[model samples]
Target: MKMQRRSLRIEETLVKAFIYFSVICVVFALFNILWHILSHGVGLITWEFISSYPRDMGRAGGILPSIVGTACLVALAVAVAAPIGILTATYLAEYAGKSGVMRAVRFSIDTLAGVPSIVFGLFGFAFLVIFCGFRWSILSGGLTLAFMILPVIVRTSEEAIKSVPYEYRECSLALGATKWQTVARVVLPAAAPGIVTGIILGIGRSVGETAAIMLTAGSSLGLPTSIMDPVRSLSLHLYILVSEGVSFEMGYATASVLIILIFCVNLITNLLVRYMITKRMGAGAH
Candidate 1:
């Protein structure tokens, strides 16, 4: 019995050591990449670089237009996607309940999620840009990104909603509340963190997309005055700089900015989520 116990202890120690080593490797990899980018690019980040337009195909000037375009694309995509995704998730979680229709819907969403971004780009170029008369503009690009991120939002939100305690629903219903009321007041609030997390993930993916944005949004360096106007994004700008051999320094600079932008977005969204959760908890306590 003692020998068996010793062996078990040894096995447990080995498993724990492996887990810690895996974690260390992941963290090291992330920091190593960050260090490489920041070390090479941080020196190039200037106010002028951030606030002005590119000159001579991104070799001499700033990336203000690309930054603006990226913001517009991401915002428009998330704005269109979030409500629709959430509603679909709510329906799937609350109403679908083992139906053939649900199975088909799930299959479709899974397929969409697995499809390549380039395919989405092509579809957007052919459909929205050509067929729907949107043209190569923010509207077309944003819509394409929306479609790409929709599955992620729906899946994440459905899981979040499902994770909410059934007892919470029961309690709300017991207190003379309707189904919708219970969902709105209890379930949604509880799932807000996860939903926001999914939205953040969508935003991250949208920001980093180059192929889809390039084909759909167009790579014009001009500032977009309206959604119909063609614009360039940071990722596309970086791609042009590197792929076309315009400037490696400029490309690295753009990469640094993109990384910083994503970090800021994630930080701000997480803070907001935390605040919402804290406020809800305080209300409950009161």
Candidate 2:
């Protein structure tokens, strides 16, 4: 008995040590990358650098166009995907039966989530850009990104809705509420945090995506004034700067800005999610 207990203790200690080591490694790597980008890029972050248009093949000028494009792409992608994803998730979680069709749908969603981003880009180019006649514009890019992030949103939202307690549904029904009303008034509020998390993640993906945007949204140096206009995102700008050897300084600066932008987005999303969750919990308590 003592020997068994000693072995168990050793196993537990090893597991704890491994967990801590993994966390430390992740933190170290993140900070190291941040430090490198910031150190190289900090000097380039002048007001002019941020606000001016690119001149001399991106060796000079600011990244305002790229920044704006990124924002528009992310916004359009979320606007397109959120409602569809949420509705699909609700149907799968709350209405769908365990039939072969449902199983196929689940399988397709899982497969889509695992597919490469390049594949999505190509599909967008082939379908949205060429066949649908959207061409290389913000509309094409946004739709492509929307499709790319749909699987994530659907899966996350389904899980969130599924996680809602059965008692909530039961109580709502007991109160003579209709099924749809219970879902709208009780279940959805309870799952808002998870739904919001999925949306945030989808936005993050849209922000960083390069291939899909490049293929569907043709990289233009100038700012886009309409949905049908092509635009260049920050990620694409960084990619071009590095690949074309325009200016390592500019590349680093772009990288720094991209990182900071993503971080800010995540922070704001988390804050909003927390506020919503807290408010929901308080309401529940009352």
Measured by lDDT, the strongest candidate is 1
Which residue ranges in model 2 land beyond 4 Å of their true spot? Answer: 1-22, 272-286
90-158: candidate 1 lDDT, tens digit per residue: 989998889999999999999999999999999999999999999999999999999999998999889
Task: State the lDDT of candidate 2 residue by residue for 1-286, as single tens digits.
Answer: 9999999999999999999999999999999999999999987799998999999889988999998888898899999999999999998999999988789989888888888888988999999999999989999999999988999899889988997879889999999999999999999988988898899889888889998788999999999999999999999999999998989999999998888878977897788778766775776786
Q: Assess candidate 2 and give its TM-score to the true structure.
A: 0.88
Clashing pairs in 2: none
- Per-residue error for 133 in candidate 2, Å, reads 1.6
- For model 1, what is the C-alpha lDDT against the true structure? 0.91
lDDT of 2: 0.90
- Give candidate 1 misplaced runs (Cα > 4 Å): 1-25, 268-286
Quote the lDDT for 208 in model 2. Answer: 90
- At residue 185, what lDDT does model 1 achieve? 94
